[model samples]
Target: MSKPRVIYWFRTDLRLHDSPALKVALDLEPECLYPIWTWDPHYVYNARVGPNRWQYLLDCQNDLSSSISKLNPRSKLFLMREGPTTLLPKLFNSWKITHLVYEKDTDAYARQRDIEIAKLAHEAGVEVVTRVGRTLWDSDRLVEKNGGKATMTQKQTIAAGDKIGNIPRPIPAPKFLPDPGELNLDFESQKPDIDADLNAPHRSSSDKSYAKIAGPNGDFAIPTMEELGLTPATTPHRGGETIALKTLAAIIKDEKYTATFEKPNTAPTAFEPQATTLLSPHLHFGSLSCREFYWRVQDVVDNYKGKASQPPTSLTGQLLFREMYFAAHAKLGFSFEQTYGNPECKFIPWHLPSKIDPKSGLKTREYIVDSAQADEWLNRWKYGRTGFPWIDAVMRQLRQEGWIHHLARHAVACFLTRGGCYIDWERGLEVFEEWLIDHEPACNVGNWQWLSCTAFFTQFFRCYSPIAFPQKWDREGKFVRRYVPELVHYPAKYIYEPWKAPIADQKKAGCLVKGDGSEFEDGQLKLYPKPMFDFNERKDLCMKGMKKAYSVGLRGNDPKVIDGSWSALFSDGDHPLGRVEQKTRVDVDEKVGRDRKRRGQGTLDNVITKKE
Candidate 1:
């Protein structure tokens, strides 16, 4: 008699090595093997998964298929559509597969989807077994010591005090996997196998070459948006895992730049890695476990103990991973999205750039503005062409590439909702959703709303000056010049502040300020409207908003979102909502699910943003 067949569903964890769930399935010794990915339309519509992630997923699946072919050449990956709840039942019933295997994810949507799938599978008399992947410590592993016995905390809050000092290490993968040929299932009933040839990397034409160079690791081939049946949504970031891993390797090799990772303002360049972990997409897919990555790094640290190189920075610490997990849970408890539901939705009396008179020479008293005008500005901004030089430069880079440094994300967001005194963070966030390959609605809205003083404790709201920030981050101005070629001629000194350069210097640099030189663009160049809004003026406006925000606290100072357990040590005393915890204890009652409104599960609400 043939052995039972088991289907292993692949989600975010992609790599073959150190995969706990995969190891378990293989250990079961099924006679037939089924690896699957279900693409849900809701996820795609919400922009939860973009082309960059999708492309990486394809690469990983291709690689997995290749690895399996060596042992069982006929093994293939099944690409199915619809939610897991609907698809799993159909596949299980049609194929008569008795068992299913997968890694359990604590994310809001994934949890909900899993529950529905379990219900459907139960009705179909199929057993669905799930294992923990990604993190070294699953949420169930950590708990508070209550009355001499360990008790798990209900909801998504992290444990109080220092729980990490004594926590046990993560479980390793099983040593052996069962062969694939033994499984007993009707494999013929599943969808046709994908072509392994089309997945190979190919030579790029010049236009294709330009497109490829726009993403993090820009050399690999990615299926077009059409192939994935996706509408042509804009994507600025392009490189997939091939580049992600390469970038990580580069970061690890730069021993001299270790100091850069120490400061919040100067951590490892998200794009320029010493040793790239090609792990994000994998993490998203459930192919490579996060525990595996943690252990891999920990192994390196142990070997290098007291050696020439120090252990990985605490910023990349294991505790940080736990913190992210816990915070995401907290965010789920409260409706983070509704709390900051498009702040620009209610208020909208914002100013636009005044028109310049052609003959009278003075600025026009009126503004040429409407919803259409705002829409036009939004399009230019999203495409990275607001023409503010630095702002546009950052936008252009994101337009060409799928990823940007996290700090750069804050920088661009601040420049818009705060620095520009724009009334709408919703419009800005819409652009982010459309263009960012790594865009997460919960993360994006929360951060933009946080930075714009629309959510959380908006009391200490902050924004970066569009003109001054470039000098601080891109000092040589090369970063800006690379993406914004129009300003390439300007020297490093005047590059950041093109309007400050003299007319003679501007002309020498190729483009005159405001373009006209026959009008005698001489003397100190009075070109390019002198800083649309002065740095001081904008800063003052932002400060006033911050002060006004102090009165409106987060969800009425709910403890889960603002409790002492969640305090950041780096806060100062003067801030109204200081880093200290509040007395009110928030009780999170809901189990993990995809509903963003119930609790803050999987959201970044509690992650410390303060730089040491």
Candidate 2:
């Protein structure tokens, strides 16, 4: 028999280091090997990727191509344009491909896409090989070990992981590569219907990414931001295997930090050199392997004499969190993204909820703008005009840069969902998907649920004080100053609550905290919006709503929730409980007295008593 003719498909894994899938492809010792990346239209048009992620992807592809060229001058990642489902079979037959090898992608859409491609490969009589390398253990296997249930918590993830064998060590990249066969793609291209484009909002110019079967230049070149008709990316985070390996080397060198690293203790305000290893984006693009990160950190803990942090909060614990989300998400396919039809997710009637896809019964990119107030608040939150400086600052940082600290994520997510705005977590999840350079579907969706108290976490009463939480990490408001520069000159006393500053003090700061968040300016003050709503009132309202929902105890998949009858069980204003009215200070005092009688302690309403 002739030697194997292989096509090494590059998808999630974009790096040369510690790639088990790449190692297996190399071990085949093929006579000819083609390292290729199909520029799938699904991502280009269907996914809600923004300019920052697109730029990062291009950077990774270019870097990987250059690295491959260095190993073997004749071999590099051959780029192709068109849907992978259509492109792969044609290439298989045309190039006389025998084996098609790639890393396993357990993402819901990816699994479906892979199944379609595998069936096509079988029809063409080409052997398709895949390996699980995205997560430490296969997400599917983890789910199976957990009795076919979602790993909802860190403890559950650890329990399920124990059944799976110890994670395999990293595989070294090949020193050399076999040259690719004849590169001639002379076939009719099934150009994606641009009318169905989901990322049309990002495109100011016409998208030319899928203009040709082999990209615009017709040499299978990586497309640029310009080619995709995207605005210039504002993010400082760059992606490449070369950069990722060096980062891991530095982190591993700091054995003390590596051994004792705790996620909770990490300062959310810290920057310049970020608090945590900003390797999440690297991990997302598979520029670095999860197994490689896990073991190196484990080696540090094993040898260190000092007491080290353990799972659920340790540096290794973060990996387990990722795995937990992956397994949980894999367990419930598309429904994992939204509360609807997800048994694990508790049904909450949030304002500005996600629009559902009728055919597939999944959430769409669009959301139902049911409440104008919720819509305006969401718009304000996204633009860093949320009145509260800490929340505003984090949102600004996220918008300007593609990354933010994890706790900062919690603050914004909590503020958006259960704590402040009473908006849907899915809204925030979609925004993260568009902006975060390191956004992983499972982690993003799972985290949103956790923060919203919709699933994983049941602490509806626990809310991050946008003011107090940031103050804990940054008492002087240095982080707020950096991102929300307008509030820079405001005193630390009033930085978190600039609207509360005396009018005379606001003048000294060269700004007045005014406006209703919907408008930009007031007179000559360059007015920042007033607090969107009474934070305490909103918090109290949400707490009451959450408790009521918990009492009902209906899951998203419940017949009542799916049939819309769930709405009848609760009221819709600010809280499921009726609203309180106090026309005067006397009335307020009386209400406070009645409140003391009703409960032992007053709600968060007393935290900041006055309205903005």
Candidate 3:
């Protein structure tokens, strides 16, 4: 029998290290192995990606390609500039491929795409092999272990993990890769339509990445940011397996830090050196294996003589949280990303709701501007002109660096959703999707839900105080000064609330706290916007809205929610009623409270305690 001619598909697992799928393909002892990556247009045109993420992806691809060349000079990651749906079959036929292999991705889109590809491969008489390496355990297995339900809590994830057996140790990288067969790509490329590209706003020049199937040089080179028409990336963070492994080595060298690390204790305001391990982007890009990182940290904890911090806060606990979100997304599929059809997500009659597709019953990736004020607030929030210094600083950091401290993310997310503006969480989610280098769909969506008190967390009453929250970490407002340079000279007392400074103090500071942060002159003193709204009043309003939403207790899958009749359930126009009309309201509130208590819902005290 002819030795299996394999095509090793590189998707989430960009690195050669600890890749289970790669190991399986090597185990087959293939005569010819073709490592390939199809540049899917779904991500290029449909996904909300910015230049920073594009740069990061290219870095990973280039590094992987170079690494592959080191193992086998005749083979590298073949860059097929077309959708996999159209490209793979042609390659299979031309190369006479006998086997297909890849790391399993449980992401909604990946799952659907993989199913179609598997069917096509079957038709072409190509066997498909896959293994889970992205997360600690297979997310689908986690859901299965959790009684076929989404792992909503850390406790549930832990329980599911326990039943799923210990997470397997990472496999070793292959020392020798098989040489690929003849390279033949004479087929025509089917380029996607760019007329309504979702990322058009991000591109400064015309996209030429798709001009040729084999790239500019016909050597299957990695596409550059210039080729994609993306503006220059502002982020300093770079991606590659080399950088990832090096960073991990440095982190592990500090055994004490690695062993006793706690997420809650990390200082969000510390910028020169971020508090937590900045390995998230690496994990997202699959430059670093989640299992590799987990085992390294776990070994440290196991060997530590001192008492180590434990889960829901510890380094290991953070990984569990990641697994939990993955399991949730795996169980819910596409519904996990949005509120409209997600049974797990709570429905809030927030301003600027998503525009749902009647045919698909899903969000159209567009939102209705229900309130002009809210729309302006969202735009200001996105551009780092929110008037709240802490919020503005965080937003600016996220925009420029494509990363922010976790607590900083919480503060800004809270201010945008339930805690302040009461705008839709989906709007804020889109911004994060566009900017964050470490933006994992499962984690981002899950974190946004938790912050907005929509799902995962139900502590709507416990909101992060934009002013007080940052003050706890940086009393001197040094972080603010670094990101929001206009407030650099302001006193620590008024830094978080710049508008509260006395006129003389503002003048002495040389930055006027006036206007709406839209004007600036090169020779003039800086001008910062005033606070957008009274924080205390907004807080109260948000609290009332959340409480009303909870009392109504309509989930995303509710008939009323699906049919757009949920608005009639609320007393105020677009606002949830603080008081309902009948005794039914009292019963609903009582039942909801009981359910919350039963679920062991956390309170503001729990968050404060965790921080302390």
Candidate 4:
């Protein structure tokens, strides 16, 4: 008799350690254990993604496959056609799959997809098992009074009796994986086009050169974007498990830059300093786990005892993980449209660049205006061509390197969503999704909405002063010069505001100068355009609009509504029943330990976890 076969579906939760879903799948003790990943077109080629992120994902998948293969020698990753609902059912039915293992997804789209898949699996008589690997607390377990959704802010008010405190600690991975011989079932499915589909230009043409630049310290082969049916990106992003871990380790070991983490951005001299990890791409590709990452940092802290002045604490850990959660939910289909005053703004007025050839008078729709202008701005922002230095530099880093500081995300988003208010936040959010390797729908949407003052209770709109921002954040304009080469020749003072310099100064600075000693080059400032909207004017407009909206409101204890709620009745609210607290509890939870570890180290890694 053949041994039963169970399949593990790899999504964002990639690492093997403390992977609840993977552990549960192994517990089934099936004849064959199959691990698979899909290059779904809806996610791969969507406007919300780009080249840098694609490269990073490729690296992550490679690492994950290598890890699984080592543990289960017969376990091979099945790369198949797009659309899990369509392909997954076919594969399972064909192979007589008995059990399906996967991590629960919180994103709206994933949740819907999972429901459909679950229904399909039930009809086919296959048991589907889902584990809570993505979040610290399982969605089913974390609730408020009357079985409602548990909000982060509400958890704070409940003290020891709050929702998370009462939930059972999730089980960790077993000491050893089940043997491949135990599940001796044999099945085959058409492999995904690993080479042709993901054939993006690697750093080198030769496989050897590609491997050298790949920097992965594992046995797996990285797939190209084309192999994954993804479009070849104009630029590449760094990816893989080794790079992510190394980057985290480096941030932890650094000793000289300790002051950056000590204080918040309250004093002018103590402006917020950013420490970053380029783990988003790996996280997206299932090369890393949030729990594993938390534990890894804990290990680093334990190794570097008392080397730094400040110790890590719950406050720092909360600030760090909050953003991670924020990114995940926002990126997964919360849609950039909801982050503005007018949800209809998603379909509002916006320009699409002309693709028509001036010489031939040939009109082209390839560059037709899109309903989502917010997404368009995101494209520009990702490429670092938005003309906003602070925003562009950070965005450029994400595009070119697949990494940037966390606070930088807020700074840049503020520049786009509120700085001008002339553009849409959706555009910015989409760009973030496309370029950022760590793209989480929740965090992306939350950050954008948070900066734009679009969602939750706080309608507070903060428009950044572009002119002053350059001086404050990038005082020397080094970051701007590195990414925006057009301003390379301009003095540090004029680098950010090339349009403000005198004509002679502009000429000397190699900038285009206009007549009458003004710096308007070629109809308008070429290198640097004038401020999109008068900073003061936009500030006044946002302030008045916010004041009117929040005049009479109840401050709901929901992290989503960080600024509280308005009195106006949207009675059928998304979270109508409020937060719920679960009664049963686990003696030990990894999340609590993970949160505690941040305080013990106080390293550069801790800086990122601390609040402003």
Candidate 5:
């Protein structure tokens, strides 16, 4: 009998280490092994990605290709410049492949695409095998353990995880890989349409990524940022399995930091070397194995002499939160990312809501400009000109670096949603999806929901203060000065509230706080925008609106929310949540103020400190 000729599809799992699927493929002892990656147009044209993330993906692909060459000189990651749906069948027939193996992806799009591919594989007479290694445990199995329901809370995730037993240990990378058979691409390439590209705004040049079936040199090399028509990446972070392993090794060597580390204690304002381990992008790219990360931290905690931090906060606890989101996403499918059809998410009647397609009954990925003022606020917020120094700094950092500390994320997200703008959380979700290098569909949607109090969390009254929240972590305002350089000369006392400084004080500081942050005077004093709105008043308004929403208690799946009848629940007015009676607003504000003062919580610090 002819030995199995295998094609190892490299998708999310970009590394060669601790890969269960790779181990499975190697265990077959195939006659020839072909490692390949098809440059899918779904991500290129359809998804919102910036230069930083695009660069990071290229870095991972190049690193993986180099590593494969090291193992076997005759083989490397073959770059097929076409969608997998059209490319894979041709490769199977051309190479006479009999087996296909890859890591299983439970993401909504991946699940659907895999189903189509699996059907094609069966028709083509190719055997398919897969394994789960992206998260601590198989997300589908976790849902099964939870009685076929989404893991909504840390407690629920923990219970489901306990039922699923211990997470499996990571397998070792293969020392040797079989050389591939003759390379042949006898079929024509099918390129995707680019007229309505979702990422057109991000490109400064024409995209040439699909110019050829093979690469420019016909060597099956990774595409470059220039090929993708992306601007230069501004982030300092780089990606690779080698770098990931080294970073993990260094963190594990700290022992105490790894064993006793807690998420809540990490300083979001610290820069240069960020407070938490900046390994998220690596995990997202599969440059680092989640299991390897978990076991390494777990071993440190197991043998530690000092008291180790526990879950929902500890390093292991962080992994569990990731598992929870993955399980939830797996259970809910595409609905998990949006509020329209998501049963778990609450209907908020937020401003600038998603424009629903009447035919499909899904978001058109375009938002209705219901309020011009709110639209302007969102644009300013996206470009880091919100005038709230703390929020602006974090937003600027995210735009330039493609990553931010978790608390910083909470501050910005809260400011954009229930806390301030009253805009839909989906808008913020789209921005993060575009800019964040570490963006995971499950984690991003989950965190946005938690921050917006739409799902997974419900403390809508607890809002992060644009002024006081960052002050707790960065009293010196060093983080603000680093990212928002226009305020470099402002005194620390007025750094977080530069607009509050007297005009003389602002001029003396070599910057003027005026205009809407559009003025750029070269060789002259700089200009920064003033606070967009009164924070206290907006907070009170948002709280009242949240209270009204909670009282209504309608979810995304509600008939009223699906139709247009939900708006009747709120009184007609200019306010996004409709006019809360003046009397009720004042009453709730006073009561909340008294409660907060009694609890010694002057800011959102106390409320969000314990959250993951």
Candidate 6:
């Protein structure tokens, strides 16, 4: 038989170490190996990725390319610029590819995309080998073990995991790699149109990454941030397997920190050296294997002489939460990302409702600005000038650094959705989608639902006080002061509520707490806006709205929700209301469906985010 001419596709898994798919590829003992990254246009043009994420992705790809070269002098990560759907078939014939392999991705888009690629491979008589290394166990198998239901809770995930036998151990990377076949792209490149680019807002120049099939150099070189027309990434955190392993080694070396670590006990305000393990971005990019992280942390817990923290709160618990989200997304598919059309997500009448695509029946990235006040509030939250220093600090930190502590995430997410602005959680999720370097769709969507009291959680009345929450974490207001420098010199008593400080104190602080926070007053260089609204009043209003939503007991898959007439059920007395007029892309289309069950079992059933 002809020696296997294998093409190893690089997707979720970027690192050489602990890569199950890479090991399977090497086990083939191919005469030739081609490690390639297809720069799919789906994310480049359609997704809401910001500069920070783009830069981080490039960092990982370049780092992997360098590592691959180090393993073999003649080979590197050959980054081909084209959609996998169009490019793979051409490459197969051009390179005489006999086998294809990649790490399994269970994301809705990825599943569909892979199916198409697998079909192409089959038609060309190419054998395909796939391995699941992104999570503890195959997310699909976890869901199947749970009777094909979405693992909505950590308990469900744990039960499903227990049934799935043991998680796979890490495999060692090959000491040497076979040389790649002759590089040839004799086919025409099919470049996607950039008309409907969702990330256009982040770009300051025209994007030219798609100008050539092999990244302008014709050597399959890694694309730079400049090639994508994005502004320079401001995040201080970097990405690479080298960095990921080093960081993990450091954490494991400190046995006390690893064995006794609890998520809740970590201070959200801690920065410079962040309070918790900042390995999430590495995990997301597949530079760090989740299974590797899980086993490493478990090993420490087992060997520890002193008391070790337990799951749902322990380090192992954190890994399980990630697995839970992965399983939930695997089962629910595309609808899992939004409240609409998702059976698992509870329905709530939130401001800035998402614009559902009539043809696809899925919510688009765009939103209907039904309320001007809510729209303005979302802007304030995004730009980090919400008048609440604690919330503003975290928001600013996220934008500038592309990350914030977990509790810090809880605060900002709650404020954006049900807790404060009464805006849609989708809005906050979109911002995170753009800004988070470690943004995993499953975790972001799941956590948003939890924080918004929509599905995974239901503690409507228990809200984080913007003033109290951060004060509890940082009494000196260092975090708030660091992010919100306008109030850096303000007295600690009024650090969170800078507007409450006396006028002289504000002046002495070298900042004025006045105006609407967008424009400067009297040409003042540093002016902080007053609180957007009375926090006490907004909190009470949000609570009342949540109660009404709870009483109605509707879900995303409900007929009323499909038609969106669910708004009528939420009376004006339930919460404050307003109207905003702007040039929106799509107006609200009232399409009514035959009402199914008007009530849901979720009504007063379980409160997952019940202030634990």
| Candidate 5 residue-wise lDDT, 1-612, digit = tens | 999999999999999999999999999999999999998788888788989999999899989999999999999999888998888888889999999999998688888899888888889999999989898889998999999999999998999888888888878888999999988888787987665677766688998888988888898888888887888999999988988999999999999999989998999999988999999999998999999999989999999999999998999898888999999999999889889878899888788777666555667555555565776788778888889999999999999999999999999999999999999999999999999999898999999999999999998878899888889999989999999998988999899999889989988888888877666543588888878888888888888778878888899888877766666677764355454232222243454456446545422223223321
Q: Model 2, range 561-599, lDDT digits (tens) per residue?
A: 665667667655535334322123233345445645553
What shift in Å separates residue 288 of candidate 1 from its native position after superposition? 4.5
**Alpha-carbon shift of residue 595 in model 1 (angstroms):** 28
Local error of candidate 6 at 108, Å? 1.0
Task: Give, for candidate 1, the lowest lDDT window spanning 10 residues.
Answer: 603-612
Looking at model 3, the pairs that clash are none
Q: Please, what is the TM-score per model?
A: 0.66, 0.92, 0.93, 0.67, 0.93, 0.94
Writing each residue's lDDT as its tens digit, candidate 6 over 107-156 gives 88888899999999999999999999899999999999999999998999
lDDT of 5: 0.86
Instruction: For candidate 3, write residues 62-103 as lDDT tens digits.
Output: 999999999999989899788898889999999999999999
Model 5: number of backbone collisions: 0
* Candidate whose TM-score is highest: 6
lDDT-superior candidate, 5 or 6 = 5
The positional error of residue 174 in candidate 6, measured at the CA in angstroms, is 1.4
On lDDT, the stronger of 2 and 4 is 2
Clashes of each: 59, 0, 0, 46, 0, 1
Arrange candidates by lDDT, highest first: which order?
A: 3, 5, 6, 2, 4, 1
* Over 4 Å off, model 3: 573-612
lDDT of 3 at 472: 91
The global C-alpha lDDT for each of the candidates, from Candidate 1 onward, is 0.48, 0.84, 0.87, 0.50, 0.86, 0.85
